[model samples]
Target chain A: MKSERANRRMMTRLSIFAVAMFGFGFALVPFYEKICEVTGINNLIKPAAAVVNTQVDKSRWVTLEFDANAHGLEWEFRPVQRSVRVHPGEMIQIEYDVRNNGAKAVVGQAIPSYGPKHAAPFVKKLECFCFKQQPLQAGESKRMPVQFVLDGALPADVNTITLSYTFFEVKGASTAPAKGGVQG
Target chain B: MEAVHGHTNDHSHDDHAHKPSGIMRWVQSTNHKDIGTMYLWFSFTMFLVGGVMALIIRSELFQPGLQIVKPEFFNSMTTYHGLIMVFGAIMPAFVGFANWLIPMQIGAPDMAFPRMNNLSFWLLPPAALLLIAAQFMPGGGAGVGWTLYAPLSTQAGPAMDLTIFAVHILGMSSIMGSINIITTILNMRAPGMTMMKMPMFCWTWLITAYLLVAVMPVLAGAVTMTLTDRHFGTHFFNAAGGGDPVLYQHIFWFFGHPEVYIIAIPAFGVISQVIPAFSRKPLFGYASMVYATASIAILSFMVWAHHMYTAGMPVEAQLYFMYATVLIAVPTGVKVFNWVATMWKGSLTFETPMLFALGFLFLFTLGGFTGLVLSIVPVDVQLHDTYYVVAHFHYVMVAGALFSAFAGIYFWLPKWTGRMYNETLGKWHFWLSLVFFNVTFFVQHFLGLAGMPRRIPDYALQFAEFNAISSIGAFGFGLSQLLFLYIVIKTITSGEKAADRQWEGADSLEWTHLPSPAPWHSFETPPVVK
Candidate 1:
């Protein structure tokens, strides 16, 4: 009888411990997420901002044509390209168009980079679709242009700067950088 | 009146029961002594296995060129050595000592849960086996360092999975062991022994157990997230997948930071017990020692982020961690001063345990000071991930924990074996280890400050000489450990019989009531404390 009583008491304590541990562990889950969100570190998926890209550089911006299946995107991007070299204090311009080939409207963010060391160029803009999430209506197309001068501060010995963009799907639309160009 | 009026207490002890002996006795043992013996031997085997891995690493690092192991293999050795030493050797060794001593000292018949104690110990062997087998897996054992940082670890091979599994099992074992310790202390003390009257070793275990309880599960959670991220495509840490990698670090150090103290605190306990007994004095300022230990455990949680200063935590966050890390020195300072104060004005004798205890006090304090310096964020930015950090921890752990363990063994081996060890060879073991250990790690601080990073198989031309010297010192230190093996074997096989009271000042209940080798079964009925 005494052993039975002891066993029963032990079971009670064990159950209590189990409950307490669960409560303690569960209490932490919500607290951790709230803290992460408030810190701008919420890596969890959220809606992206919207903006549209417009072609700004008119003349030197050579139009681009590429096979859509090759790059694995649902849109066609036409780019203005080809510059041999630029002397110091020269400007170059480029233009591009994104034609939506998908059945549904899409949202995305465009990451743009430039030069042999791509992604080092700091972009300044009068207007950009990238300022917020981008959204497009179904069966729609848009043109984006990036224009800028090669700063005179660039070393005279250096030559060639190529720009590239990899777009991530966002909630709405992407703003484009201004496009333009001159001799190298 | 040389105790002539005593009612033949000696013969009364003899009259109780002769101890059960040998292999069968150990297999089905519940006695703390038998279990402790098993733990000690097992831990030493692990130390050698881990040491062999260390030697492989050092040999590869003997010169700037890697002649022995490949880079992948070098990474494996570093990972395996750390895992084995931290889990397999030091922590188990301390638990073993606690198992053997806490009940004995507290005057309880056995641990609060004897059957569970056996189960907890038995789990370690299989866990170690699985970890070792991981080396033969598809890409070889965890190329990730002991930290096992995420995304990289997730991207690694099958070996990483196996290592994670091993960590999960080990964490469970630690939790069970720690819970057992906390329960035993809370429920099983003798009637007369208040918390204050409890031995310093028990006091230390109580605190260590608390640290283990609070942190080991966090480690479990961290590893759980790692497992999920690797297998289930959960973005707990992948930035591309909507998870932040730094979050993984925050959770890991929450566990990792206290984990070091978990290893160190019990070593502190061992020294606290050994120092006073050999010094022929009661421990000085026992209350303060208790407070200091408690304070250290509390502070361990606060200082986890100090490790993340380089992880790009906010500057304000860095400042907070830095200050908290340095403040740890105050309580730790109290501990060092208390140890020194205990030795002052006392009739101190340099017994084997005393020799090791004193070694811990000196070397551990130096290590702690370095730890303080590491906490200084500006200093740490340069020292982080360098050999200085390596040297600092080794001085604290190898010199501090391992030395104290050796001392504890020698001090108690007489009472456990009913025989005294050969004093001369024991002294040789002490001197050789102490001299060579310092030689090996002291130079590492210089190598670290000179901008050498750890965990690489090769070095620049300038680092070649120090690498050679450090390797040589390592070999010497490794060989001296064999001297210890000789002493223990020889003493156990044949030596002079010891009296029940092995040391004159030893007053724990183990010396009073239990005979040498304790018994095959004790506290089948609990002994009353008074």
Candidate 2:
């Protein structure tokens, strides 16, 4: 009888040992993962403030000035002093001061996408005017501009077309980036 | 204790009678049959739920251009479908089989920990609920794909948190279950049933459990970092905050790669058993098969970066991962060769189970070949995240793991339920799934080569015809599973009687003596094996 009791105890101890071993197994890999995170071997996530910047590469530079156009159509391209001779592969920056001169806010989305029929190859986006959703407060304005490289491989025939965008208010405007340059 | 084979007056069955039927019966149950039934049914329900999610995805992907859902909702479908299939469908199905067959095969009375077995299985339902609940959360559900990469997942909404919690629970469940398997196989084999004498299924699962215990926690930790990065302000992945996003991929694949093996090992176990029964011979290279399985499990840990080769890893890291990925072909090739050798000159017949096993052998090896091609560094450069990758995984998951599981279920149904499934309908189900499975996925390889990608709402016109054909096949495959549900139900409700040795070629202890349609409580008193 005592031996039978001892056998039961032995089984119990064995079972506990088994459970402990597996528990150790279960916990060990995750502990390694935690170590990976601490040591940054796993490179876990970290949050930070939003930032934006731009610098011009002199080799790939062209400039256009849409100097102070105060009068135009209800919906018109702000006139620019242009007709400049740019090499087939020269990148150009279009700088313009844009505004919502109307009484109500003007809202719009900027999609910097490739081509009329997949015609333009989007080399890359350095900084897009579309990063933050834009809504011009009533009688508000801002400088909405873009800079892009015309990859040296741009075809010679497609060199003279005007690259343009039109900003129309979304039915119900919600963001605050559109309050840039309207004089009260 | 309940008598295993219902001879309560015999000395071997002494003091083993009268099983309690209420909840306490389960709480304190040591009966392998009872535990097995619980596992099989739980896995079945999870399969049905996960299946419904698959249909939702197929229906939306049926024609592209955002037919029935928004992009976020679409992302949710993809995420949940993967998560559910891995955890809810495949893993649970293997566990169910393990609970039912491991003890019998080893000639043991019960698993090592009876109470913990119940707890581990029960934990599954709540974990499943947490995953399903994420769909209804404010942000719909997790949309950063199933890998849940760092900055994208960390910046994701509350849905990701729920996914993390769900992963934690699932990992715990797998760990617990793995431990139970290890202990049962290690300590409880009958006196003469040494490691070499054990059945192939038991051998395969023992290795599978080792893989599971080692990796599930790695998964838990990967998700935990995602959680803390979001809530605790840690910069583990945020580059702006001194964290590198690529590190998340490294950590995740560390666990994720082994996870693929964890799912496959049990399926390998199932197919190993089924092939022999149908082949009318003992398994060839039993020792070699065991060694190969162990080798595959170890290699799985080293080859994870193959998945990340396209994430802009350094050239040296890429080369190391590439060669390591290719090395997998050696052991995996050994397994296929052994399976074929077992059937080489033997009297082979195609039972439903054997057909699925054969299907798994042929197609999984095909998938592995494509995997070798994919592991090549230059080839992966173009194929990563493309339709090619989708085809590779589907071949393994659906054609390989899932088909082997079906073979196992059909092979063992008679022993488990004491009823014969209608062979005619079983054949029809098999053929339909085979035909449709090939039609759907076989064409995806070409589309991938031509640069079609996954997770897209639309595609170029050149890829349209193949996409449409694949969609139709997906629908057919989806519909065929209903036939499977019908077959299972009809067998339980109305099939004819099953014999003690259901299959003449069967050699395992499961068929050596236990009656068909195992009792509600079985094997409370251990059997002696030689």
Which candidate number maximizes DockQ?
Answer: 1
Segments in model 2 whose C-alpha atoms lie over 4 Å from true places: A1-184, B1-18, B22-30, B520-526
What TM-score fits each model?
0.80, 0.76
Q: Give the TM-score (vs. native) of candidate 2.
A: 0.76
DockQ of predictions, in order shown: 0.08, 0.04
Q: What is the lDDT of candidate 1?
A: 0.73
TM-score, chain A, candidate 1: 0.46
The residue-by-residue lDDT of candidate 1 on B182-288, one tens digit each, is: 76776677667789988889999999987777777777777777888787756666543344577777777877888999999999988888888887888898999
Query: For candidate 2, lDDT tens digit of each residue in B101-219?
Result: 99878876667777778888878888889988999989889888888887689878898998999988988888878877887887777777889889989988998887777667667
Model 2 docking tier (incorrect/acceptable/medium/high): incorrect
- How does candidate 1 fare on TM-score? 0.80
Q: Over the stretch A11-119, how does candidate 1's per-residue lDDT look in tens digits?
A: 3564355345434433444466677667633422332222133334332322212111113347665554533343332333455566667777765445443453421
